[model samples]
Target: MSKVDADTQSKWDEQLDYKKLPDWKDCASILNKRCQYLEARDSKQIRSEQCVKTFNKNSSTKPTIVNPHRPQTSLAANQRSCILCRDLNHSITNCKKFLELSVMDRFWKTKKLGLCLNCLVKGHSVSRCPSSYKCKTCEQAHHSLLHRTQPADTNSGIDTPSDTSGQSTSAATHSAMEKEQVPEAQVILATALLLIKDSSEGFQLGRVLLDSGSQVNFINEKFANSLGLRKHRKNVDIVGIGVTETKIKYQTQSTIRSRYSNFEISLEFLVAPSITGYQPEASLNVSSWNLPSNLELADENFNQPSQIDLLLGAEAFFDLLESGQIKLGEGLPSLQQTALGWIVSGRYKSKYNTTKKASCVANTLEVGLDKYFEKFFEFEEIQGLRSIWSEEQNECEKHFIDTIKMLPSGRLMVQLPFKKHPSCLGGSYDIAFRRFLSLERRLSKNASIKSQYSDFLKEYERLGHMSLVPNPNLDEDHYYLLHQYVLRPDSVSTKLRVVFDASCCTSSQISLNGILMVGPTIQDELLIILLRFRLYRYALTADIVKMYRQFLVNPSDRKLQFILWRENEPTPIQTYQLNTLSSVFG
Candidate 1:
């Protein structure tokens, strides 16, 4: 919402019929009421006789519907296609093609920087994974330092200050063999021997890993074996991706952030999700592992430490990120316990898409409440309502009816079928389920409360009394106004009062937040003014009817930058648009 839009909304609200208006100050308070249904009426009259409360309307015993202008819609275009994914004109943020695509465009680029967090998988950067160099320092919390000292023996090449065990000069020469330690970085990167300590369930295995990107503890066969850990049970689900090895090198002594001598290193191993083709969920038990002796021998004979229950590789990393348990260690806690790196940053992926199809209709029938059914099902039955769909989806009609009949959650899922879901994405089951649930709006439509919210605002102006009404279903007008403008964080609805006393003029400035309000007017007339004050600001007063109800964040994240209105608030403001922000009450 813009300042002009807000101001315009105020003007029209002032011009509405104040004599018949209701008393509610805002829409939220009105909708918050718990009323379920109102008695039916046959005609359009101010006085309603069938309602629970017999209200007066001039002077007549009449029966009439409370709101008759519910179906009013303005003429406008809806839904823009996604630009990157190209599947839709709308941005990937609002595209429902695949959540993975959304994540790729919205999160990976800006978050990953140059790291390859998704090296084990497809479509991602590497920076998302843990750094391969945090092990050598002393302050490392878990592992304790222990160095082996050899007794003095010139023959064995064990030059020590004390007496040495007697041995042949040849044996001494063999003993003199120096164990050149491979740098921890080289070891992690060069080797692919992720441990599989417990493999009793032949072919089924689990392991431990050290993924700094992870939050909570998880277990995977590859991660377990990376630390060279042994387990009691076999074939147990490791619960995470395989632990991979990558090397690190430290050559400079002065390059330390906290404090420590920097040694040269290289990396190779990996910690990754163990899912077969990204299938099979691992049952993980998160328990802290006891640390091994922390030995930081300047000599190249030691290994680094790693520790984590299920060190989520690139794939599983974001699942548990919000929980916030994955951490980076300061020093050598133990091998496989601590991750070494210049810094550790988490990478997240998001895929959210919603495509509503009205031209695309489904075959489902709606029936009125039954005697035994009314006691059980208060709303219409799924079988009787008319459906404009094909034979395959007609089963959905029965499914919808049976759903509400069989399960309690079914009624809550009131599905109003339409050609709502677009056929695409190899057409997975998840899409089918979404299409099934899209049919519940009929109840609101029949109840005549679809426009209950907006109508109540208009009524408040007419009757001067408080009333509440239910919102419309998906195929209805662009309902996202509730979330985008009304409820979205930091939206205009937050800072400005929907209704004011007209005395205190505390003005607030608002932009579209990148959210385009779609499908405002199918005709030229203002269907009840959304904003009573202004018409157009920035010449943006158009709306699209087709909108993405739920918007997933974008992928690529390359051009990702959150425009901040002020300092101290570091959160990036990535706005997801439904279609276009041009739609407004003109």
Candidate 2:
């Protein structure tokens, strides 16, 4: 018989009414009911730390009922058997079965074993329960006492005595009659991802628990086996919590890459049984790396992962923490001032997961020089640009007319004509002309810009830059049509100039400048001056007014410089050809 049963029988012998004490058969029935109730209750309550979770199945060979780490041949001859389940591996107080029993059953179990009444568990008395739950009736923090149920007159303020002993119960007796009602203890498990490495392989991801309270680091045997790590045969004692005895565990050395930083440190870890509870429904042949969860920001339940393959204890945790690779939360209570109210809450920052994605979107239009240049390169293929220009042509023409009206009425306003109608190949050149015209009108509002356009043309005409092409001079080849605009309308200077494009394509898809020449290039005058300074220690510079127009061009080449011009809408467009090498030469 168990020591509890023997103790219960001895207590019955000391009772004043020995004949009224329950018989052995009745006691057995009560014990059976107690076990059944405890089992039912335990099925309802879930323990997060000790809860069963499914893991990678490739590591398992077959489904087994016993502890996977414990050898089948191992004997527990010296271990004390639990009074509730008769298990030799754990004590009665620590038995999961007994701990789930109801308050009444728990009380009887303790009383029968001649144990404390306050804490139904053995080895403690009424003064100490170590429970955090407060009383549901009296608002006190003690187990609820079973008060005698007595029918009383509504007018009377006292409860009639209901005890069969026919005597008044004292406070001490009432306290002993209280049942056990202690809540399960809560534990904080800090889990993170660590990079563990073996001799023959690169660093691999391993789920680790940062336990600063533990004296040493630990790695599960299954995890180490998965990594194919070699273990040293060291018979080291692993002491558990409280007065629990130590067990032998093997030791192994591994290099762990920190989750927060690039630091990799060598650590000695004890290889022990897997700390995770097993799930029976999990398969036995799955092979896959346990990837860390990619959590979104709004996921409220930021609990640790289900499985922890390693335990990084004080030896490694503190060192990592001191090195700024890990950090811990403050244990003190704090309040935060928010728009709603003062919120009392604690925050924990994990070293492994620094940030979470709040939202995602596809950005195809990010602005950059390369992106703009890419669009510019694709300008020929863009059909929408043609339609856009078609819609805005009228507005562009109206703006151009308004700019012409704004200039002095008597201003020559000569129209540049072409020797022949230029090919508007794919009409891109027309689009370019419309853009130039619109931009010119918009820039004409600035006084500095208006002067630049007028001054450049005045200089060209005054220098006899070009002459009217003779009516008899018959030229079959069409001259390229050019457009002009202020180079920098924003700049305020008398010399601020306008640039006329000479690379415009003709109807034949060719530019006059493009076909004119392609050979040795002219030396940069600045570079020439610098070279002379190096040779002769002297340099000279001068401004040659209309030097390009003064340089004579061969008369035959003048045909290629033909242009069309008109003073106003009423004047007919007239043709002219350049007789000077004044314009920007190709």
Candidate 3:
């Protein structure tokens, strides 16, 4: 081993002097143990510092401990002195005066008492509390007594529990004093799982939320894209709680069907980037709650947090609701009968100190606007706006510049800009093979198309665009691209062309295009080019023959561009590595 650093040597010397070891062996053992202890202590200190920094970054205000050096107190001792009424006979839970306060008021009282939200115990915050017990209702890390509940009719807007009785004046005074101490309430929204028809007429199970407060129906943009539905451009502003606005740029129509009954409806939804964050926020235990055994739940996993794919607004909400309704209890979600099925909604009572209420509003707009402004200012220059590129796009451009080289034959050689190492690209040979078999079956029905495809491959091989793999066994970093043909019967130059599917998913459910960086557009738009052509006295148009083949890929990356093929059924399938850049690849 190398000699110890100065700091380490000094530490060892100090330990040895203090211990006064007799032999070198004893001194070494003691030094080793001391070093481990010091290392652990330093690591722990570093972790604590990191945690504090993270906490400070997330919290708007820092917590203040009035007496940090005070001796730790237990729950039994705290119970003797109620924070609400200072009663010596009973604890906060049993205190009659505390029970008289509203749920919102109780929440503020708990905050003021400086007790742990999870256990309502003194001496530690919720994060440091050793208790594993959580709120029975929401299963969140909070005491059940402090759990707040809102009305089931979330569409009517948030209704704060007010003490509107004889003590209204005093209640108002207390409310004003504890306005800042109020925490966001957490309430469960009505969600259901319904069958949504895709473009292919196939039905997919999607999680839909019933939001009567929203004037128009909304769908998650990513989910809408996955359905392959035709979208029409229709920009509109969606305003939600606190006048928060989000721009919806597209709208699509989809048919939804009930899983239990023959109920079906066609609905139009405005597409947004995201509907809302995950519902429930966290998972809940529903085993204890006695639900109706005869009723079939729309969403079986309503207790679990999940992505909301579609939101049915007021237009559809009222139409779907039936007259049937069942109340479970005062603190439990009530089952409401709808065309879709029985959906659980309403106030659930628990003892959590605070709950983060989930709303149909888009809360991320401010952060998005901040980022947009930051980018706008960053790219502003004397001449005009500089080219704006994301970090991924910039990295892609740099990768191309760094890895691109000119071969002896004057062909440009480049490496694939993979976001991750190639080893992580799981097995794709089976998928490619299956796709190839399907393509073969389709081609067999048309002899002319099959012959044309064979000729194209023959020409491709003749020109050295691709070569047979010497060994059929795939390497750890290998990938296979599924190949298909696109028929351009109207084209004079090429009637048939083979296209490689770079987006074909592997066993890992990730494709080459998914992990690869699609570099920014290097060519000008067609509209811009056409407009510039009009400015010239003479305009000429030409096409470069075999344009995609001009650029060659590096030898090391050839394995990742493998394809399977067989001219005839009698012959075994063969693997070929593409040597040149293809137009279809991202």
In terms of TM-score, the best-performing candidate is 3
- Kindly report which residue pairs in candidate 2 clash with one another: 415-565, 415-566, 416-564, 417-563, 417-564, 417-565, 418-564, 423-507, 548-582
Q: For residues 323-407, write the lDDT of model 3, one tens digit per residue.
A: 9998887677788999888998877764433344556556344467777767565433122122655577789999999999987
| Runs in model 1 lying further than 4 Å from the true structure | 1-161, 164-440, 443-455, 459-512, 515-586
As a TM-score, model 1 comes out at 0.15
lDDT of 3: 0.73
Ordered by lDDT, highest first, the candidates read 3, 2, 1
Cα error, candidate 2, residue 446 (Å): 5.0
Prediction 1 global C-alpha lDDT:
0.25
Q: TM-score per candidate, in order?
A: 0.15, 0.24, 0.40
lDDT of 2: 0.46
* Cα deviation of 244, candidate 2, in Å: 57
- C-alpha lDDT score of every prediction, in listed order: 0.25, 0.46, 0.73
